[model samples]
Target: MQNSKWVDVAIVGAGLAGITCGQTLRQSGYTVAILEKSRGLGGRVATRRLMATCADHGAKFVEPQGEQTQQLIQQLCDRQLLQPWTAPIWTVDAAGTLTPTEPTPRYVAPEGMTAIAKVLAEGLDIRRQQRVVEIKSIDAQTWEFTTDSGEALPLQARSLVLAIPAPQAVPLLEPLVAKGLPTAVLETVRKAMFDPCITAIATYPAEQAAAWHRVGALQPLQHPVLRWVSRESQKRSMPGHEVCVLHSTPAFATQYIDAPTLETAGRAMLQAGAAWFPGMEKPQQLQLHRWRYGFARSPDPMLEPLPHAKTPIPLVITGDWCRGSNLESAVEAGVRAASLLEQWLNSGHD
Candidate 1:
């Protein structure tokens, strides 16, 4: 077996949480490595290029709430990495009456939402397509991990962070509990719940695009199938055609989560969307993306990353699921997780 160089910290799931955590730790002079399962970087901050245009199929936009998130947003804006989505957002009630939403600024990237991840990921050591399969505590101050890469050797680190969803993280930590490690943290991770979502991206001809020219996006209230519809082209400039992103209700996603074919589900969502905006049923191009852990259910805003137990090394479990189901929450959690890990290291726990 080949031996790889040990790092100060190794983080799983190169999503927002993992990237943010790694970035913060690196600023503190720690050598960090971010391991991602997917070829893409951002977890939910995704964008798809189909037909002649692109659409943000995962997170529509980011609305900063907390102080840290606001500061991050301002920094991104100053660098021209992000811009305010000043387009009008309207909400549709059950009676089909549309009303303008509050004039709060929603931020988006000019190229795509994934640009945010790319910006934060700059200058970071991120290993993509490396799905961590096993983690074991090697000693009082070291941990080792093996990925699905079919390599004989495993990576070692003084500290580790599981920044993926709870369901995905549980299996990796379960084996450690047998060695008297992370039982308390495991229970807390188990308590976290997530809902699935089915997102549909459709592009319409210019004739149909003019119908909704005044509206930037629509939130359908009390809808059984469709939950949100946004003109993705408005966020950028896509000529000759319009791109729209459709999000299915959580209930609809739950029912179709295990469908034999997702095409049917995608069509069904488009059909429902047509009821609100005609011509959505028939798009020039269509794409579907399913998120298994789309949103966290009733996450406690006051909660921080799960505190480590009396293990030999420092281990942290964190994600958007640790707090709320939003980009801002994920950023806040990552910052906090980095701080906690630093504390543990400073106290000579690892």
Candidate 2:
């Protein structure tokens, strides 16, 4: 995008939350621009290509439950970008005993989970890979930003929305905190917690997964290292090949959060997978992804001071953390932020 002097809104982080908020405010007829640090969209709903195969090492599926969320997923389905994924799953107990879980409706994209984000990104002024480093409030209504690149001057916007993780959002809003923001909001930001996860992607031989196709996914037993294991190829119904994504438990991720390398974390999770699937060939390819703020561990709204109204800077900060930690949660948080911003702007109140 060309350097615009100002915009109606300036959003930081182009993840699901940010994108959802963008869609909402756009419908409200507000000109918006988004700044994302990543090369592509979808913060946790990410995928990486492995040789000829691709693995969804981030968010696996979309379980849109509420009315609006259901409508959103239905749109993706009508577009043929997303298809229903009905894969039998098993839940393992603490003692390593496995029990088949009842069937549930799940959805997946043929290309990758990020397709949802791409769909939401249509007709939006999103500036990819622009890492916002600092935010300055010229006044209650005007805010300016500086990016990692020093080549350009500050970009201005009338309002701001933070669609990134809560932990990441808190530090960026520290300036507002020092500006005598509400104590309740400041406490929520300080106390909000996030749980990290290490995702491991491993590809086995073609025929190996089809043989055990009955088991679509695995919520492994009290395995210290592995928490979630699923075959992405099976989910995609791609015919042959077995590409699996393994997620480390919060405890395990925390333990290895400071591990030396990604390979180290990947190896640990891969070895654990070996135990569950015997005769499983050595991985043709293996990779690891670290999400420092993977899951929102914040208290429930009933427990914490998650007032839907009244925030600082006309800068509404939210993510999956305020609500539950899922694709659904992230989208809902974005809606809540947009709604609050709309009311705040309309009332001519701060």
Candidate 3:
């Protein structure tokens, strides 16, 4: 075995949480290395290209609820990366009746939601496409991490933070838990749940798909099949490129997660979306995306320290599911996790 490389902090999962953690630690004058499984960053803040059209497949827009988000939004606005979405949003009932709701200002990344992740990841030592398969306490002051690469070289860190979802993180922390770590932390992690969502992106020829309403997006919450129907093109003022992003309810998505085709997997969602919004027809191009851990279920373990009886390396478990009350909860959890880690690292324990 090769001598493991070491850093001050090692974080897995380069999503919003991981990136935010890396940013926090780096700004605090600590050396942190971020490892991500995917080729690109931004776990849920995703964007895709439907031929020539740009669609936000994961999070459509961010509605800032907390004070932290307000400040972040202002910074994003100053950088010209985010703008307020002033479009009309309506809720369609089961009877196919459109109920226009009051307009609320939401922040949207004009470049794409991934732009936000990119901004947070700037100047951080992020290792993409490297999934840390195993984490073990080598000594009291060191923790070793093994990646999924063919060689599986070991990397060690003085401190570790997990910013991924609970389901994904549970397996990683299982080694520590099985070694007689806190049972409460393990139970809390097991109880963490997230809703599934299947998004269908339908793109049409230029000017072929016309808007039924002047609004930017629509939500068919009462519909049995479709949960949301958004005109992604309208949000960014993409002229001539008509596109719609359809989202299925958690139950429906779970039911059809294994369906064969877009027609079958998203049949109900597509049919209901087209029925509610005019010109939402089967498009010239289409894409299907499945988010098994989409929206997080509320009330999870957050801001708690998982103290090891023997190991000196402290572990902080955090994710969007911590307090899934709102979209900003994940971001909030990320910020808090960093603060906790910094405090722990500066303490006598480490």
Candidate 4:
């Protein structure tokens, strides 16, 4: 490969794992490029803004556990982009009765969940809307990738990494598979399954907001909706005082997996929520978000520590599935991938 245009590494998918890996490699003086198929960043950490109010349509909040995730959260908070929200949580039973639970503070981004991804992508060489169609190794020292737009991007590196989900990564390995890539890797990818979820965000009038809030916590784990109602206005960073977000139960989401439109499903959810609030009126701003690859149900914990090949591919697959479903798990997978890749690059053991 020619030296003029070749990068040291090419990261496919600008999700948490890809962004973290790019950041790590760049800090180590490696020329890296991130290819994101979507127009914006934040694969699962999606946020939507409406009429000056910000609501998280993807990941609602994060519960930090480890030092790395906690540190990341602290840095975001220091930037004045995130805040802690304390609200009584509830679980609805089958009979549609509400039951309040212990109040645990949930942290949310003031600007939105997408703000988190934007923060991470800062100063990184991320090429948005560049969809990588195929990856082929050119000799033992270089790799070439062709985009869906018929553009060729070549990388000359000692290593390469794939930070996308295992299922998404499998199709890209067709060339390697044809050349007889490890069966174990293929099998592991095939065995992984992601659960689906639907999130609904609705904005009611000020007059109706009080009626809904009176219930305190709606639907305490009885219906198809697990977490029934959260006052978006009560959230620290949310701008409006009339918005609310409702997350549907995984079972309900699966049942409606083939729903013709998300708007229909969202409308149905809003109707159900209104039942608990007697005086609740129709919402003005309603949106539905479908997470096709929401979370991992049962995953292989050992996938992260999988051994690399003798002629190691820079490809490393990481996501919430590799560990557990949550913001912390996503960050952990990213940090872990970075650490492992850093060690591999320094080992001199090709």
Candidate 5:
């Protein structure tokens, strides 16, 4: 990107919302740039490879609740990037009793969760490892953004969209907050809470893998330690490898937030799962991932229609915390924010 020229928009946080906003803005003929804090794209939508196996450590699956999201899922399926798994997800109660609840078919990326974000970011101007430290309005028509690396990238546009979480967006908007905006808006942003989660990925020997298969121990709704588990190699477009992924319940994760050793937790989860597969053995390779802000608990209700102020600047905030806690909600929030921005830009108002 040319430093001298100004893009129409600068989107922060290259997660699902940021990427979706960029795609929509670009389609509307706006020159856009995306800044990401991570080394790679996809914030919470992450996937990892262990030895010869691949596993999804974040965002295990997606269920379309609305027509817009359903259409998006159809598009993804048409591209051969996602496939539907059986419905009625299994759940283990606090007493270790397993129950299955059938709902809509849960869809997972064939490769992994990150595959969906990768497909969305295609042909977009994404700058990884560039974390925005500050954002301020230069004037009525220009905005200035500075990265943590001490690089100043000025974006002169009629609108600005913040696709980061509500908690993170609060500090960034301190100046505006200090200016005495309505307490309700600020309170709503502050009230949005995010829950933490832990994912454990394990790999067993070929014989053990076959043994697990026979016992049907890896069913999505059968185990307590695992919210969703799948053979990585069995997925449609996933890399051919033997691996199993496990996601712990939010309640359990809160208990071990400060645990010294993750292995202890992993072992506990493995032991909890042993009842289903009596002969199951310990994994040869084990990995654990902790997510501090895994999902939102109380998301802002106004997320679908982002709030904007005419006096301050054309600043709009959006994220999964604003709408719902899922990939579809994040994308829908982005699209809605983009639409609001388009209207603001055209009307020359807030």
Candidate 6:
């Protein structure tokens, strides 16, 4: 049955951007719903359990560079959702020469990385596994969203916030140009570009990983295949086995982005990493993940307040790509997007 729901605002992509936008709107007494395509939250702030231990496959740690990010970290720490990872970061050359890096503050979640998203998602109406396939303007004041599966009912809202990746958001927004959607908005979204990334999770015997107590995390310098390798156990205490997460260079990911299978790419990354970290070539278990839009090559300019005067309706585009490809960028974009939609509605445009 294609039932329908009406809300003050509807958000696509329950990543930090969508969740942040929804939370911001809900605080103003607006009925909002966040639809997520995946079962998990936090987008790239993800973690996975393997064998007795877990590995942070996505962003290894959070380093607050700005005041806003620092404030966010302090809040999370106060709530016990975040803790400082005082481990040292080192740089490794192609020939496996390790050099010490300057000390910096990095934070992590003891429970898991996704815990950060869970806390931010509190008291919000978040619907997971809701893949939005189509978007339509239902008159000037309302927008409708159709899910990929028939099990979900269509959602209608007075305003819409697209918090997904630029590449994914383009398809849904393209057809709306004929329906009064601004070509400039679509063109701005198109200006954003991303580089692909391939991540591999590997686990080895606990004894082997314990041997490298001096090693924290390694950033490969000018490596053709491997870019980063994280020793998961170094930051957090885990038992039974040692976990390592490897990230491939953008060039490597581009070459294997459309391959029939990623097994070859995964193995190549692990093999390349073995040069710096022994036993990486052999693992008890291995898992592979591909991020088609991993890092932004070019990000859209940060529009503090969207130009609502020229917009046809209360719709805003937002994502990490709207600013930069970091967690802070996503949060900031969400806040700006929410501010735009709120202004549009309050100005009697809704």
> Which candidate should be chosen as best, given TM-score against the real structure?
1
Query: Which regions of candidate 5 are displaced past 4 Å?
Result: 86-89, 94-104, 154-158, 179-184, 214-230, 236-241, 258-261, 277-281, 298-304
Q: How many clashing residue pairs appear in each of the predictions shown?
A: 0, 0, 0, 12, 2, 0
Best by lDDT: 1
Q: What tens-digit string does per-residue lDDT give for candidate 2 at 148-243?
A: 885443467777887777667666776676664565665667677888899988777777764666677899777788789888876665445678
The TM-score of candidate 6 is 0.94
The better candidate by TM-score, 3 or 5, is 3
lDDT of 5: 0.70
Q: TM-scores, in order shown?
A: 0.95, 0.91, 0.92, 0.88, 0.85, 0.94
Q: Give a tens-digit lDDT track for model 6, residues 231-264.
A: 8887677787788889999999999999888999
User: For candidate 2, which ten residues in a row score worst on lDDT?
Assistant: 302-311
Full-model lDDT for every candidate = 0.84, 0.76, 0.76, 0.70, 0.70, 0.82
**With candidate 6 superimposed using the best TM-score fit, by how many Å does residue 197's alpha carbon deviate from the native?**
0.4
* Clashes in predicted model 6: 0
**C-alpha lDDT of candidate 4 relative to the true structure:** 0.70
CA shift of 257, model 4, Å: 3.2
Ranking by TM-score: 1, 6, 3, 2, 4, 5
Query: What is the C-alpha lDDT profile of model 1 across 1-350, one tens digit per residue?
Result: 25677889999888888899999999999999888888999899898877665789988997778886688789889999889899998989999999999999789887888888998888998888888888877756677777787553356788898999999988988888887775777888888899899999888887787677778999999998988999987798888888889999999999989887789999999998877678889988888889999988756654654545548567888888777878877887898899998997777773
In the predicted model 6, the residue pairs found to clash are none
Task: Supply candidate 4's per-residue lDDT for 183.
Answer: 62
Q: Give the TM-score of candidate 2.
A: 0.91
Candidate 5 global Cα RMSD = 3.4
Per-model C-alpha RMSD: 1.6, 2.6, 2.3, 2.8, 3.4, 2.0
